[model samples]
Target: MTGLLVHSARLITANSPGDIRDDPTGWVRIRDGIVTATGTMEGWAPDGDEVVDASQIGGPGAIITSGLVDIHNHGGATFAFDGSIEEILQAVDAHAAHGVTRIVLSLVSAPPRALEAQLTRIAAARGEQPGILGAHLEGPYIDSDRCGAHDPAALHPPEAHELARLLATGVVQQVTLAPELTGGIEAVRQIVAAGSVAAIGHTGADAGTTLRAIDAGASLLTHTFNAMPPVHHRVPGPIGAAAADDRMILEIIADGSHVDRTIVRMLFAAAPGRVALVSDAMAAAAASDGEYLLGAQKVTVRDGLATLHGTSVLAGSTLTLDRALRNVVSWGIPLGAAIASATVVPARAIQRDDLGRLEVGCRGDLVIWDSALVPRAVWRDGVRIVADAVAHNRPLAAG
Candidate 1:
């Protein structure tokens, strides 16, 4: 049986909720693409056919954590996920460079036929690529007032035919729509019944409507506070309603642009263990500043911020999980907690417990980094995707 071992590394992982064991000097063994054993420096043994000496790679402060799982992302190649299989693979390689081992490909607003076509393509790729976690439709049923980068014309009430077709594909794992739409709450109920996550976002719904959706089994809030009404002292909006609901999983983009660092920390405190940091990245991610297409919408990327062309409306983002972890740590959050937000938190949000964390039964996906939070190597399904850092000399530099 082929095996690999990582020894003398700082393992930043949690055995369970509230049981984070950020071991300083730890070792983990992987056999047949699953973690088989783990321990600290006490009585380490070289069992892997291959070994990674974290100390030699980056010396002390070398940290290892379960690979990040991005639950919301449009695309990352120069092109978007709304492309061919090869383009999707390009995006996968792009984000993998930034330590994202698992991803739920996001699709922007489009006609039902268009979205369904894209979804079918992504569904096929999901089977081909273990890293792809299926599709997340972020539009076609969103509130026009807060559509963000989505096309207002494409936004409409969730129809049963469209909903039924999507569920039949068995490709959609999540749907983001305004609960105030006609039949929205009923759609939420049906979405949950069909084994898909119902999320509220791009919404102008009031607190009451938001809570009703939660009662109807809507469990996630998309990019909290981005396209939704904020917490008003008089009328608490979706953000307020979700903040008070323990059953809601809040998706926060920690890129420091979509959300401020201070507010992100406040949300982390407000939601406790229920917050999942998502990139919401578009095609410009892992690339230089340029223009890109996001679901027939033109977007400009400059200085890492993606916004609509000829307008100030912020588009998705150019964020990657690695940069998100660095941003939070720089804000004074503990490294272990920050790491969990990018890793385990998002995994659990998507109900993929088999992907995150370093345990005997979990997938052998992880990132090796330094004290500065720079990813040196990334492994997906026990295969080293990022063999080495070409920019190792520029370690710890903020993007």
Candidate 2:
């Protein structure tokens, strides 16, 4: 890669309140695929390499935010996770065009043999793609009652040997399981011990059981309200427990179907900076209304709503993080808070300190949006990956 110089842009750091420093005429320098320096136009000048004038692309009101980090997603475009390696690459490229720079490929519940084979393939393909972060196993050990679209036959208690083997692959970055299931609490400890984040999801655990799981080291609540039991005056399920815990990070799918707008607002108010907006999208994302396969089950997409072919249960979302950000802001969330949920909070959830901020020494992953908050250009690791060059290199396929 080569050096890059970005000039004349409004930078939104999403770091602190004072971090949104305006620069009618400022410049940011990148060298060796990292942000080196940023300052006003008078203090910095481009010496070599490529120079990008942000104003020329999106004009004065252009908004610049950190490249989004989606830690959980099953598929996008027409590619499903269960497909071949070529299909995975196609999915990664599809999401990259939408300003997602880092993504954890979330896999639904599957048999041990199938899951291991998929993990091995993903491990082999790491670093070959720009934004393929790692794998997120969201299954095989969860409550059968809350399985949602996952195949219930594959649900079982987490085994120590099986989990050790999955972690040993070095490709699994996050795992979601129900704590109330057999051996579930022990599984949380084992997953945490392997340096991977253990998330609580697809669960039927009550408040006490949820608290115990948190005490055991599960730090994430996957898709907060969709798979878990609903909050009631007497029950106060996992959602309530997560709300009361300060150390937990809650994931919300803001597709407007999986969660109510009012409920999303309440979660934002309750969690403050701890909520991370995730897509939880499957193969239907960025694709048209049609039939699609999620793991072993079939789903039908209608008006962007995906559901199991014949059931009322929602399968997953067809949302992208950029659209989710827009939805939150549309629901009266502050732009800064909404941006933080999509960027900083998710980055923090995965314990990635270097990303989700535009400070010096951080990776130069950024997106420039027009006044309407539509992406105009996206950059990953100081490299301009989206523009006329990108369009020519890889034209987007029609959804």
Candidate 3:
């Protein structure tokens, strides 16, 4: 890869608490798809390759942060997870423009045959799309009573053979199930043993069952507080279990409607660095409000509220990670904490140590945003993918 230089950036390193550093006259050097050096303008000058003027691109308010990582998202830009390769790529491109550099394609509840076909297709597309990290299976093993927005008829207990087949496709990275279901805790162990993340969600699992799953290697809570039982004084649910366990990562949909701002603040305070903000968004995101398909179900999105055609249950979110970040910040969360939820927390949840930070030896995926926290430019693997001067004035994407 060729080398490039980024100068005059307000750097927010999502490394530690209070690590926001502003060097109005600073610069970063990129070589071989890694950040080689960073420092102030005093002794910094482009020597080997391109010397791009970042201020000219993004103006004075250019803020540089790690590329956003979304470990769970069903679809975006009118593309559902069950679509063909071309449609998936189009969805990914739409999300890339919004600064989502890495994403795990989440699949809702479906039959074994349909699930297998989708996984096989996604596995085939893996090499062609670098941002397509892996697949998240969020179905086939959940509570029938709490299966909000999911086809309850498709719910079933985890079968080792079925899971083996999905894992054999080499595209299943994360699977969400209810621990209280038949064979659910054992399924968590099986998923972990297969080298994929196991998560608990869409269930009526009580605190005891939830913790047991965590002990059995279920490391994530899929969209906490949405489909699971609410936390009650007498009966603390999965949300409480996740909050109490430091090893578990909780996924929060911060679209302001799925969760309340006060609860968001509480979760940030309770979980600190373990919360990952996700856009559990469906096909309507980044597209106009209308009818969209998620798996076999039909959803209607009106005024940004997505719901199943005949039910009051929230279908999914219309949120993007940038909007989630903004909402968290608006809820009085510290900028660093909110940013970490969208970056480091999700990266760590997926066991990707090389992403979610702006530092030496890390993948050169990044986002440059203006003062309003709007994405100006995006980079993936040192390649420039999206650069909108009027929208995202920054130059270059990644390589």
Candidate 4:
């Protein structure tokens, strides 16, 4: 049995909710793409076909964490998920370079036929690539007035037949819909029945309506406070409603533009162990700034801020999970908590408990970070993907 061992660095991971463990001198062992054991260096014995000494690789504050999992992402590297399989792979590789090991390909609002076609392609592609977790439908059933960068013309009320057809594709892991539509609550139930996550997003639903969706089994709040209404002391909108519930995992786009970082900190406090940081990125992510397409809308990304071509409405984001991890840590979030938000929290949000943590039986996916929180190396399925930084000169100063 081939194995790989990494030791002599900090191991920060959450085994269960509020059960984060941070070991100063820890190690993890992987065999055949699955973590086989983990503990402090004291228990280490001779093992593994290959070994890495983390202290020699990453400087003083080197840390090892599970590979980041992004549940809400449209596209990156000048390619959108709505394109052909080749383009989708290109986007996946682009994010992989930035340390995202597992990701859900998000598709913006489009006609039912177009969405179905894209979903079918993703289903086929998932077989060829284990990293392609599945698809997240950000909508065709949402409020037009709150449609951020989605084409209002492409929006529609949820139809049971239409949803059944989409879920039948078997690749739709999550569906984001406005739960206040004519049949919204039933749609939530139907989505839950199909074994998919029903998330409330791109909606104008107030607290009462949002609570009803929660009752019907909607477990996620999509990019809280972006396209939806703000938290008013009087109204306590969807953000307010979802924050109060322990069952709901609130998705936050921590990029500086989408929501204020100060507000993001508040959300973490409001919903401890319940927030999942996501890169709601479009094609502009990991690519040079320029014109891009998010669904049917034209977007212009300048200085890394993406928005509708002629309007101030944010299209998606230019964030990657690695950068998101750094952003929150800079905002006073403890490193362990921030890492959980990017990894374990998102995986649990979609019911994929096996993908995001460092434990026996979890996938062998992780990132090695320097003291500055910059990823120095990435490994997936017990194989090194990024080149080892130890082979180079002493680490360069992080910006």
RMSD of each: 2.3, 3.6, 4.2, 3.2
Worst 10 residues of 3 by lDDT: 390-399
Whole-model alpha-carbon lDDT for candidate 1: 0.84
Query: For candidate 1, lDDT tens digit of each residue in 44-146?
Result: 6775358888777756789888888899998875868889988998898788888888999999999888888888889888878889988898978899988
Preferred candidate (TM-score higher): 1 or 3: 1
Question: Mind sharing the TM-score for model 2?
Answer: 0.93
Each candidate structure's TM-score, on Cα atoms with residue i matched to residue i, is 0.95, 0.93, 0.94, 0.96
**Per-residue CA lDDT of candidate 4, range 329-360, in tens?**
88888888999999999999999888889999
Compared with the true structure, all predictions reach lDDT values of 0.84, 0.83, 0.83, 0.89
Task: Report clash pairs, candidate 1.
Answer: none
lDDT of 2 by residue, 81-163 (tens): 76788888788777777778888899999999899999887876665876877899999898998899999999899999998
Candidate 2's C-alpha runs over 4 A off are 16-27, 40-43, 388-399
* Predicted structure with the largest lDDT when compared to the true one: 4
Candidate rank order under TM-score = 4, 1, 3, 2
Better of 1 and 2 by TM-score: 1
